[model samples]
Target: MRAKLLIGRHARLPARLLLLAILLGSGPAGASSQPPRRFEDPLCHVVEWRTPPERIVSLSPSLTEILFAIGCDTTQVVGATRFCNFPPEARDVPRVGGIVDPSLEAVLLRKPDLVLVTRGNPLEFIESLVRLGIPVYGVETRGRLARILATIAEVGAVTGRETHARRLIERLQATLQDVRQRTATLAPERRPRVFFGELEGAHWTAGPGSYVHGLIEAAGGENIGSVAPSAWSPLSLETIIERDPEVYWGTFGEEGEAAARERVLSTLRNAAAWSQTSLGRRPRLFLAHADVLQRPGPRVIELLPELARYLHPELWSRDGQ
Candidate 1:
């Protein structure tokens, strides 16, 4: 089955050119013709604020990261999920609960004027917040990289930080373009096949239309898991062996980094076909902080080059350049 390609959160593109088009009201075909003034969320709700929101509750970790990245005052951010522990300062923010199961009581105690959520949050929870007259913005990061940028812009618009958001987007775009230029010329056959295992126990991997898949493509590697039907799916052990990817990359969370790395290495080494492929011989396995791959936020741009270097060391070598 051909995997359906989903738009990535930070896919490589002609940054300057795309930025110019977006700023000039001439973005990619089918995109909005003007810079957003009112925040329109994925749930199709229009959110407008007379003044910048001073008290905010961020239910999504990615949104929390975005709020901090775009210069939202930390003091005004009253509540964030426990997982929103990036920027170090975010750890200081009061935790509401887990991303998918935030506590309404805790969120209410924050007295937030605005709440930021993602599609993963329960619809009923969002509805309850709306029923209470709190302004809720539901951000979705499922398909395209553009949606991720749009989420940034929307948050900036509602929070009155449009300038900061625009600048951040430009910087991110520049970095994305740099990665693209370096890898764009690689021949298809030359690109290594890569498998991104999200979880070792179930053989869980990222497939077509996922942010990880986009990252793999941008880094000049073909994602072997792209045959799956959705953004994330499990691949059978037989399928993985059949693919025999040249490189194996995965994210380790909760489990301490050292243990996670050792566990993943041992699991791969024990596979029946471990002796038949590049991974079996050289074991080109890499483990990264889970959030870097899972969170669709500004830091993703920071990690893109690192992924590129891992996937194509020859291109990144000092002698090669």
Candidate 2:
């Protein structure tokens, strides 16, 4: 499948405009081979640096996780968004407010040599930072699983840790291939129907072009929300009932496991329509660690096996034992 480019909510430019912008902003790949490095971002914008950045700030939690996974020095990572609390050590990094509404002043105060951003960040904010001579690179990691792995490579290359990045990619690729191989032979009729509840409120779910949909497909389950028009959309309770999903998965970010599970169960139990489905009767509801499942980082790989076990317990023999 072709990779989908995610430009975030703030700068939802048309594809033509986005391509033009990238063409105008960037030079040809491998424009030079000297001490100062130049690399193109997912948007095709060229980012040049005198050397690998020493003080980096990550505006997106996913990017923060990728940086840490690629083995970037923690001390050099001066700032991260408030939600970037993964890998344990990330908590020590200074917070820069929320992902979309990050404090520009706080970012500037860190005096980072490089600032990493993803979709949902305002383009104007990035431009302002550029004006102030701060190098900002946009890392797009949405849609397909391949795109997410590519983002890891991009981050590694930009940080001058290509070796580490390649190793991580290989590991991820191997795991994905193994999962695909194991689940590929299952007949369509055997594959369980799944509903991925992205948010607890209003019945938001993963749809056709979203990464979560990809995850569902990879784990040998059919995503009922794949019928939705957009990547993420709100489904009516009637629609969910009509599909009659066998499994329901939700994620919790800051909430404790017990609290998250209770909240998810409460939300489902209260919905009269949802309570009527097979998922409600047997309650195949499962809770995933929000940071692992929601963030488009290396940890997303961890979700595949968990989902497979949920959808195909007999194949696992003893719940992935």
For model 1, name the residue pairs that clash: 6-209, 7-144, 8-145
RMSD (Cα, Å) for all candidates, in order, is 9.3, 7.2
TM-score attained by model 1: 0.83
lDDT tens digits, residues 39-113, model 1? 556565555554678999999888888999999757978899999888789999999998778898999999998
Single out the weakest 10-residue window by summed lDDT for candidate 2. 1-10
Q: After superposition, how far is residue 261 of candidate 2 from its true place, in Å?
A: 2.8
| lDDT values, one for every candidate | 0.78, 0.80
Give the residue spans of candidate 2 off by over 4 A. Answer: 1-35, 42-44, 198-201, 266-270, 318-321
* Each prediction's TM-score versus the true structure: 0.83, 0.83
